[model samples]
Target chain A: MPLIKEGVLAEDNWQSLADEDNLVDGPIVVSLERWQEERESLLARNTPLGLRLRSDQSPALVVDDLERFSVVALEFPKFADGRAYSYARLLRDRYGFKGEVRAVGHVFRDQFLLMQRCGFDAFEVADPAAVEAWEQAVSEISVTYQPGADARRPALALRRSRPAVA
Target chain B: MYRYDEFDHTLVSERVHQFRDQVERRLAGELTEDQFKPLRLMNGLYLQLHAYMLRVAVPYGTLSSTQMRKLAFVARRYDKGYGHFTTRQNIQFNWPKLEETPDILAELAEVEMHAIQTSGNCIRNTTSDQFAGAAADEIEDPRVYCEIIRQWSTLHPEFTFLPRKFKIAVTGADHDRAAVRVHDIGLQMCRNEAGEVGFEVIVGGGLGRTPVIGQTIREFLPKQHLLSYLEAILRVYNQLGRRDNLYKARIKILVRSEGIESFSRMVEEEWSHIKDSALQLPLDEIARIENYFAAPRYEHLDDNVREFEVKRFEDREFASWVRTNVTAHKQPGYAVATISLKPVGKPPGDASAWQMDAVADLAESYSFSEIRVTHEQNLVLAHVKKADLYALWLGLRDLELATPNAGLLSDMIACPGLDYCNLANARSIPVAQRISERFSDLERQHDIGALKIKISGCINACGHHHVGHIGLLGVDKKGEEFYQITLGGSADENTAIGKIVGPAFSYDDVVGAVEDIVDTYLEYRTDGEEFNDTYRRVGLAPFKEKLYAAH
Candidate 1:
């Protein structure tokens, strides 16, 4: 899998460990269940930590533990399932998590712009040559209506600040 | 009608470019059908049984003459010279090649229109009363808030991929012409005891396989908190709505499974976090949107026109039309005229391109260049002079648009069923045509007054059969088509779901079943009782007995 960060292919330094796999010394990603089960051991050996949550899991469950992880990977499970989109916003706007939010599993280039607006910074893609497509997707739509996690000013705020043209 | 600003223009143009790119990618085999389905659906393009069907949103059911003419152009150039006005205050073109859809969208954008959110799992086009600004009974124009919502939900990043499609409706008048109670989020404008106007928010009402009437989650929500409050509700639904089963994914199912009290509590808890967020509407912004819907300048004239009364007395046909099609307006000399698309034996809501152009011209000449598409699948000239109605009727009669059956039995609502839709089990438009042909006599239709017969081809209930006075749902039993009848449903302020009367009827026998039901109603009705009132008073026993006892 190709990892895209900030619209470019980036190296993956973090290893996603399975349930029975031993945690290495470098930064590693663990499932929510594993994090909940071996919290003490993981905290004791923490070089860097990341948490992965399934689409069915709500971000509210790990709100108190958001400070312990440097990355939070929200799983899409499928492109049609949109629960993780809300979970990403909750992780950013509600819990004030200041870390990387990665999109994993069934993430496509077409949904990159929306995922970015909803506070996703890293995406796992099936092909590395999709970098140009991802760049074009993020910049295709320059205007949006509502406020999101992105820094772009919403149309409402722009209308409010500007004087009436007529 | 609200004109587009620079921001609105830019947003739509960008969206068109994005959709054009998506289409190119799909055609080039870069995107698969599964990946492209949501993209096309969000742009209001659906692959039906035949070619592509494109639904163009008429925001809040309002259109200018220029916009109507543009619609006529699209129908002529891209479709088969006709368009189907739908129950959602939108228009659908049945046959458009996949390659030409982007061009159609670009043309629509030239008229400040796009098909955004007309379909898909996101929020749909917001519907309001067709008689929004001109009705005498309206407390305020619901289009102001509808436009605000249109902008807010245009490309909402968080809610673009919901569990299922969402619908919202608003009505400012005491009477619910928009059928607010059956939508996913219904906003009824009302004044609290303190004399401040707000909304009575109704949540999770829908009409599909599992029909449910929405309950009031909030008795009074202040006007300024509309978007933030809606955001809270959507967030809750998006996070908690069922996603496992496609059949049970609507917000209505979630509300039903978690009880109204629990759902309301959860919504309130979610709302507490974002009540004062940037989603809150500033008063100036509200006023800015409201200015676009301000009342048009009117000439000071007498309320009663002697010439109109004289014309009415001289021509009985004109008198009947005025009684059924004309409604009172707040402006004294003005009136609202409904142009019935339902002729004697045609598809319920389909209009030809020439008819669209002629109606545009008529609207420009007499109706202050404004038109409205009703949720009941009809068109309205919302602002017309009372004295000019005779001339307007003459023009409409020539074009076969002057049926004078606005609320009568022949004016039915039917979906484009098995003929064009991929999901239908039986044909709906032909049944509507048969029913219309059976009740073609003008005097007889007037006698059987104010009945709404809605027919759906399948249980998805796009025709709103759940709320029709006499509802018909098409079913597939064995290898044949069958129709099931329901009685006494309504979509007005006192909304009620209809009940099934008896067994399903075959295509050949369905018209006879309908006639028997109507005959039973006529036999038992009082002097001035409508079909719905008669059915309510007598219940379904007499009608069922009349149909089944003879068999």
Candidate 2:
């Protein structure tokens, strides 16, 4: 899998640990269940902790512990299961967690832009060959209608600020 | 009547290019059908039973003559020389090659139209009253808010992929011509005691397998907070709506299972958070959108046109057409006229390219180049001068578009059942054609008066069978077609789901069953009572006994 960040393939530094795996020292990601069950131990040895949430898990469950993690990865489960998109927005806009929100599981090139708008900064792609298509996908739609967590101003605001037509 | 500004133009143009790329990928096998299905559906392209069915959204059912002509062009060039005006007030081309869809969308964009959000699990096209701006009894024009919802819901990042497809409808007038009560979210424009116009927000009224009339979540939602409130509802549904079972995914099931009070509380809580956010509509922005729907210029004239009156008195046929098709307009000299697509022994809602071009010509010549597609599968010229009514009727009669059966039994809403839809278990159009032929007599149809016969092939209820005055659901019993009947469903301000009458009627006997039901209504009805009112007063026993007497 290739990690796309800031419109280009980036090296993934965080190690995602399985439920049975031993904890490592450097930046590591664990499942939400693991974070909940081993909260005290993980926090004591917190070497740049990251939390992974499934499609059904809400970011609100970990709202109080958001500042403790440097990264929060949201799973798509499937591309059509879009609960993660709302989760990303909640993490960024509602909880105001200034951290890397990564999209994992079934993330494709076409969904890169939408995920970005919903505040995902990184995506794990199934095909490394399609990394070049990521940039094109994100920039294909230069105009949008709704205001998102992304910095791009919505068309309504742009229309209001633009000089009135004669 | 809202024209696309620069932002809209850019967005639509870019979307065309994007879809073109996706189609190219699909053809080249870079993307499988599984991955490309949602992308194509979101762009309003569907791989139906026969070929690609491209549904083009007519925003709030409004179309300029240029757009209608372009639709005609697409029908001739790409499709099978015809289009089907859908129950959602959009148009569907039933036979476009998948390869040619990008070209079709590009051409549609030239006329400031694209098929975005017309399909898929995203927020579908926001439908509204066909007579929005021109209606005499309107509180305020619903098109402004519909356009506003269109912008906010188009390519909405957070809410696109939900458990099921979402539909929203708005009705401005006291009469619910848009069928607002049967949508996922229904907005009825109303005024408070202080004379402030707002919305009565209704949530989770849908007509599919589990039909439920929506409950009022808010009695009065201030006009400015419409988008925010909608966002709140969508958020709650997206986060909590059932995704485990496909049949239970609709918001109606959620509202039903959780009860409306609890659902309303959740929506209110969510709304309180985002009601003051950027989603809150600004006054200037509302004014800007409202300006687009501002009334067309009209010359002052007396309401009574001497020529129209004389022609109506002399020509009985013309008088009958006017009495059925013409509706009152707010402007004194103007009227709203419906061009019936349901002719004798023809499929309802099927308009040939030639008819589309003819309609465009009539609209351009008489109605300020504007047209409307109604949810009843009819076309409306919403702003015709009363004096020009005779000429319009002549033009329509030549094209066979003037059926003089508006709101009559023959003007049915039938889905393209097993004929073109994979989901359909039985055929709908042939049954509708048979029923229409049975009641083809104009005088008898006028005598029946204001009966809606909606038919659906399956339980999905695309034909709005649950809301029809005489609802018919085509079912498959032992691999043969049989029709089940329901009586007294109405989709107006007083919306109610019809009750099932009795056992199903065989294909050979279904039209006769409908006739029997109508005959029963006539037999029992008092003077001035419509079919719905008659059924409401007398109950369904008479219709059921009459329909199932042989059995």
Candidate 3:
């Protein structure tokens, strides 16, 4: 599996740990349940920590520990479940989480642009061959109509073309 | 009536190119059907029973003669030379290759139209009163806000993939022509004691499976706070709305379960944070959108036109149409003329390419080149003058658009059932055609007076069966088509869900059952009471007795 960060394939150093499993040394990602249980113990160690959040989990859980984690992975249970997109926006816009926001599980080329617009800088997809497709998808629509976590200007920024009043 | 600006044009063209790539990838087996389904849905292309159905959004139901001509062109070029107008004020083409959709969308964008968000779970085409800018009782044109919402919701990053489809309807008048009460989010334009225009925000009203009327979260949201308030509602729903159960995922169920008070508090708290942010609509932007919908030039003719009066007296057919279809417009000389798509013994809301071209020509000549699509699946020439009524009537008559049955017995609302939609359990078009043939006489329909017979093939209620005066839900009973009848539903200011009658009737007996109900209404009604009013006045007893006795 390859991780696409900022529209390019990147080397991933973080390894995710299951909720019931013990946390290993080195850069590691953990689920919300494991983070809640092992927050102090993980903080005492010196490895970079990441949090894997399901769509159902709120970002407010890591409000104080946003600095402790270098990566925050939002889980898309399915492509159709869009709750994680809002979670990404909340992490970036509301909480001002400067760490790398990654999208994991059920992500693909079609959603790369939307996921990026919602401030997910890293996407962990199963297919390594989809990097080119993802690069094209992210830039397919240069113009946008809505403002999100990204800085793209809305179409309404153009002057209103109303008829001249006599 | 809005021509696309540079940014608008750019976005649509970009979408076309994007969809083309997606389709190419799909054909090459890079993307499976499961992956392509949502991608296709966002572009308003659907895999139906037979072929791909492309629904083009008619924004706020308003169209120019140019847009109308383009629709007719698409029908002739890509589809079966005809298109079906939907209850959401949209036009749908039934047959097109999945590969042809991008080209179809490109052509639509040439006319300032696109299929974006027409079928997705995202905020759908914002519907408004068909008579929005022309209606007499309107406080403000709802299309201004509708356009604002349209721009704000397009490709919205967060809310695009919700648990269920969301529909929003806005109405400027006191009478709910847009059926605001039954939508996912209903915006009613009203004035407060201070004489400032605002909205009465209603949340969580829907009809599929669990039908519930919306609860008012905001009593009066000022014009500027509209976007902020709506965003708050969406954010709350996105975080809290159930994704586990497809049936209970609508905002209505959320508002219903959490209690309106609790839901309102949550929305208010969310809104408090973002009220002053960039989402709050600026005054100039509001005025800019408002200016697009400003009143068109008008002629200063008197209200009474002797020529129109003479034609009505001389021609009974035209006069019958005037009685059922024509309504008073705000301007002195102009009148709103409803061209019924539901004629006797034809598929409702269907207009051929030639008929569409003829309508466009008529619009150019008579209605200042503007047309409207209504929630009742009818078209309206909203600014027709009194002097041009006869000429327009003759033009429509020649084109088979003069169906004198608007709001009458034969003017029924029906969904594309088993004939097209894959989700349907029974055929709705044949049933509607049979009923129309049963009451083919124009005079008989006029006598029945303003009865809405809404029929849906399945309980999705696309035909708005839950809101019809005589609602019919088509169900499959042991591999046979059986229709369950409901009585006294109205999707007006006084919105009420229809009650299910005694039992389900077979396909053959459904029409007779409706006839029995109408007969009962005719027998016991007061002098001027419509079917809905009469049914409300005298419960469902007489109709139930009459319908069940014959069975």
Candidate 4:
């Protein structure tokens, strides 16, 4: 699967370590359980480390490990679940985690902008082939009213760009 | 009414195209009804029993003459020659074909309107006091903040997919015309010790199956911090509100279970981080929006209009109408006139194409080109010159819009009920019509004075039956429609969920039961107190005994 980093297609660097998979030399992403068990040795690894958080898990749990990990991948268990959106914001704004916040599963073109607004710098979508089209969703609305972690100007700044039609 | 800026125009215009594409894909069989249901609801299109019902948001019940004319055009073109104004201050067209909705929305967008977020699990349209700006007693205009909330809640990335639907109502005056207590998040504008305008924020009040009066979570939230505070409350609910049981998923239920103390703490903790963030409303921007809602210029005239006094003295019928329908306006020579949608035998809150066009013309000519739809299912001309009240009444009489009942027995709020709603278990419209017809005599209705008869077809309480002074909730038991009556409920400052009096009445006896309850009030009254006041003073024992005697 292809990953989106900073609005462009990128090869997925961090691989999730499954039950039977062995670790390689490159950076690795592991489940919350795996990270909890191997926190000492995983931090000791030369490669960059990351954690994959499930929908039920809070980003507050990773507060102490903010500097320990380079990425925090939040999982969307299903389409209706929005807990991950909050987690991404919490990680980016609350904990001051200046790391890659990736949206892992069940990502779609429709919610691409929503994910981006919630501070997901990286996206490992269900279908990577649709990345180019998903990139266009960010510009669907030229202006936004809410403040988010995404690098878009607030509506006030953009108000002058499009004058009122008197 | 607020004019749409270029940004707003572009936003709504682009949304029409998005909906058009979505509808085209659904028609092309690329998307199933299951996949398109939520998407369609986000745009306020509901699949009703007879056809597609399109609910268009009348934000805070304010509409310009242009928008009103456009609505009339839409009603004539797409619907069955009429539109139903709803309790949430929206208008629902009962017979728009699914294929024509995109075109309908496109037409609506031309007049700075759309059906966006009118229905769905998202933060629905922010409602406020219908007489927000013109009300004599208002501290500040609530629409300014309501518009702010509308912009922020539109396509809100995080709060869109909440556990259940959320509603927010605001009142700018001391009197609670907006029914702020029965909303998910109710903001009552107030002044602090230092004379700063702010909101007395309440959380978790709702009417459906588990009706609960909202509790105040914050005594005073500063005006500038409105968005940040709302964001905090929503964030807390999104994380903790129940998703397992749809029945118990509303913010009211969450507030009830979590307790107000704990909920307040959580919201405060969240607000601590985002208080002065980008969501903090800039003072200039707030003023910019406020400038749109400034009071219109008024002519210098005496408080007592000699013509109105003379007309009141000479014409008994006109005097009766004026006594009930006319309310004081802030300006000395002006009055706020309510045009009741409920007539003797018509469906409540419904307006025909002719009626809509006439209203637009009337508003343009007499009321600063602004009309308001009241939660009580009536239209208000907010700034009419008292001297012209007679002419306005004559004009309204021609359109059959002059139903002199603002808070009388026949002035009822009822849902479309089984006539259109797929979720309704009984017919509310026919029941309302029957009650209105039962007590159709104008003199008798006036003598009875100020009774709220709200009937909901089902437990969803779309009719606001829970807060009606004479509340009636229609139920279906073994396929027979039965009505449950509750006494002493109000949406005013003293907000309380009505208590079910006794066993339900059969549809045949429902009107008679209501009559019996009203008779009970008349018999026990010392003075001519309103039905709600009488009920509260005397208690439900007498009313209950009369209602359930034959049951």
TM-score of each: 0.99, 0.99, 0.98, 0.96
lDDT at residue B460 of model 3 (Cα atoms)? 85
Evaluated at residue A5, the lDDT of candidate 3 is 83
**Model 4, span B91-111: residue lDDT tens:** 999899989999999999999
- Which digits, one per residue and each the tens of the lDDT, describe model 3 over residues B425-464? 8889999999999899887888888899999999888888
Query: Scoring model 2 with DockQ, what do you get?
Result: 0.82
* Chain A alone, TM-score per model: 0.96, 0.96, 0.91, 0.88
TM-score comparison, 1 vs 4, better candidate: 1
Tens-digit lDDT track of model 1 for B310-358: 9999999999999899999999888999999899889999899999999
CAPRI-style grade of the A/B interface in model 2: high
Candidates, ranked, DockQ: 1, 2, 3, 4
Runs in model 2 deviating more than 4 A are none
- Candidate 4 lDDT over A1-166, as tens digits, reads 7788877888887778774577778888888888888778777887898888888888788798778788888888766777788887788778888989988777766678888888888888766555876645776766676888778776765774576759
Model 3 clash pairs are none
Model 3: lDDT equals 0.89
Model 2 per-residue lDDT tens digits across residues B356-407? 9999999999998999999999999999999999999999999999999998
Ranking by lDDT: 1, 2, 3, 4
* All candidates: DockQ: 0.84, 0.82, 0.78, 0.58
Binned by DockQ into CAPRI classes (incorrect, acceptable, medium, high), candidate 4 is medium
